[model samples]
Target: MSMIGLVDCNSFYVSCERVFQPRLCGVPVGVMSNNDGCVIALSNELKALGIKMGTPAFTLQPLVRSGQIHLLSSNYELYGDMSQRVQAVLEEFSPTVEPYSIDEMFVRFDGFAHAPLLEHARQLHHKVRRFTGIPVCVGVAPTRTLAKLANRAAKKIPAYQGVCILHAGSAETRNLLQKTELGDVWGVGRRLVERLALMGIKSAWDLAQANPKEIRRRFSVTLERTAQELRGVPCIEMIDLDEARQRIMTSRSFGKLTDDLDEIREATRQYGQRSAEKLRRQNGLAKAVLVFLKTNPHRQDLSQYSPSLVLELPRPTADSREILHAAGLALERIYRKGYLYQKGGVMLLDLIGADRQQLSLLDTPQSDAERQRSQKLMDVMDTLNRRMGRDTVKLGMPTPGAAWHLRCAHRSDRSTTRWDELPKVRAL
Candidate 1:
């Protein structure tokens, strides 16, 4: 009677772009990396045209020039907004929904004995497509692992129209497991695939039928759980509460290489601000920050320089000012004035929820009232930024012409939120 549903967006980033521009339908469109560097997402048409992910733009420039592929810069803002909308819609369908990733969610569908699971999934798909213009594939199974395999099959088979249901002990379910590639199964990464292949577990069905004891002895509990999940046993449960992030890192490749201390400071400050924003959004504080600078790894003829500095904060704080100050100090220690630096990032570690913080008596401490007031102010700032456009109230750290601002040539405006930069859709 246990059931789980995996809802996956089809080529999510490209699909989101196509939704806004209907003309892009049936075309080979792709979304690029931070600096329009490489292909990160590809449409079905582009995939069929032999375009692959992470192929540098320069390498694919010939194909791009031939008009065989359409490209767009990564628009995370639009994609994030759409992802939230999809999550909101999915929440209405089930009491317990887990957002698995940016474009996938798993929902527990118990206590609905009479409800037709496929029909329900179909309705959900149609509603999301109609409202957001984003297509999705839904997989229903007794276990989460099988549900993921079913979703993959759903995308390949046109008859299902992006919906696959794997009932327990069904022939269709067996066929699905057989057809799925061993490498495609969840938890079966490249290294595990090679190891499993050596053991003659070459297919998903094989792995599913392997002895659990052997898997546990040879591998670990993680792979053992995967095997059990494949056999229609639910090992992973729906996570109602978001899990704590083990690490938070904000990194980017600069538009150009430069080692000027002022430019380095500007970039480090931007990275720190970004890291701080993530900390605030997650309602967590950072205990330490790591700042790193590296020159182009490819340029070996020139002496390559890469160094990082880690600094522990006096008090764990989510304040941008405090984090940036620490990051700037770290950067000053690591930055080499002569070498051109191509990339830099800030990593925040030892994160814990704001409410569950363990205060230190020996450390410089703020009173409970003062701490509450500071948190409230930050909450207000975040809320205002979300309701209005980002950076409406500027933080001096992210000032314009800061050396690390993304080189967005065709950037879209915050049309929905910004009054002055509203998008104009032409009517035929």
Candidate 2:
């Protein structure tokens, strides 16, 4: 049987926290976003307490003061390291592993027909948890869409034991499809759900039974493929690890409001630098830089302004300084005074492989020597930063007293990543 498995980490951000602070395993916890502005991740206990995702951190002050809930700041480095460990363990279980996100992966079980899939999935789940200290749910099905439904069931239902399998064309699988709501399907958004509702297709089973030909005509070929996949006909294939990104962006809200144009410019430069670093790491060059500035929308008495500008480069380059220069120019043009700026960032767009770059007739490309020299410098800088710490070597990004640095007031140690911050065991 041809089956695919999706391993989804359970409350991934929260789980990463619990790995070091084992006491937090059963505690109600919420992970706040940049500047501790809003809740982005929650533990099961937090969800049970009716603390909805994206709730502003300020509003939860009363709960925190009463000692009813625990809060942790977003620690991307730790979470990112944990994700790699989990992915590494998962790679040992399947022939092909496709990363869906930071906390989700799809595995292709093409030729492993004789072995029981559910048992294999269970073993894989245990191995990941045992090795990485992260809990996960596995969903197994013949198609990715149905596998998504099984994953949902694995997480939502009580009896699945973190592994849910829906055999192709089985009555149990049909019942599961019938049980799933139309809006809950992966690709079905509110607009699509409304349209599907008008056509009496109110559930996954309804969509599965709909005419694929008519769906392709009335809606889109994408929706048709989804419907086909829901009925166990695979449409989407596994994406390769080196899949190119459409865009790269880095943004963050400030710890406090500011009216200074230079401060906002500096923050935009920071974001642009990071975005460019990612571009170069991926071996992609961008033709445009996008800058955006915004003020707090919540403050009714204050003047609110949100402006964005796109700067097209004369020559596409992955050089951080070049990207920041364009981003700074764009920022200077769109930035407005008087309004208190709360956030700013940069985006890289119109990206293409740097190796296969095309030069414009109006301008000449950089000499091979210069390009090689720049690449070597960037490599050395990146190496130092990774070996020492973030910003161990910098290219003009402000180190101390920087507003772009997040408000991680409740951050935990980088136990696994940083040797200086590793947890010490107590001899009992």
The local lDDT score (0 to 100) that residue 331 gets in candidate 1 is 86
Per-residue lDDT of model 1, residues 270-302, tens digit only:
778778888887889988999999889998876
Query: Where is model 1 poorest over a 10-residue stretch in terms of lDDT?
Result: 408-417
Clashing residue pairs in candidate 2 (N, C-alpha, C atoms within 3 angstroms)? none
* Top of the candidates by TM-score: 1
User: Candidates' lDDT values, in order?
Assistant: 0.82, 0.87
The root-mean-square deviation over C-alpha atoms between each candidate and the true structure, in angstroms, is 2.7, 2.8
Please give, for residues 1-428, the per-residue lDDT of candidate 2 as tens digits: 78898999999999999999988878899999988889999998999989899999999999999989999898888999899999899889987888899999998776555346767888997999999999999998889989899999999997999998887789989999999998889899999999989999999999999999999999999999999999999898766669789799998888788887767777887788789878877889999999998888999889989999999996778877778889989988997778888888899999999887885565435565666777788788778877886667766746466665678999999876677888998999
* Model 1: per-residue Cα lDDT at residue 107: 82
- For residue 241, model 1's alpha carbon misses the true position, in angstroms, by 5.1
Q: Residue 163 of model 1: what lDDT?
A: 81
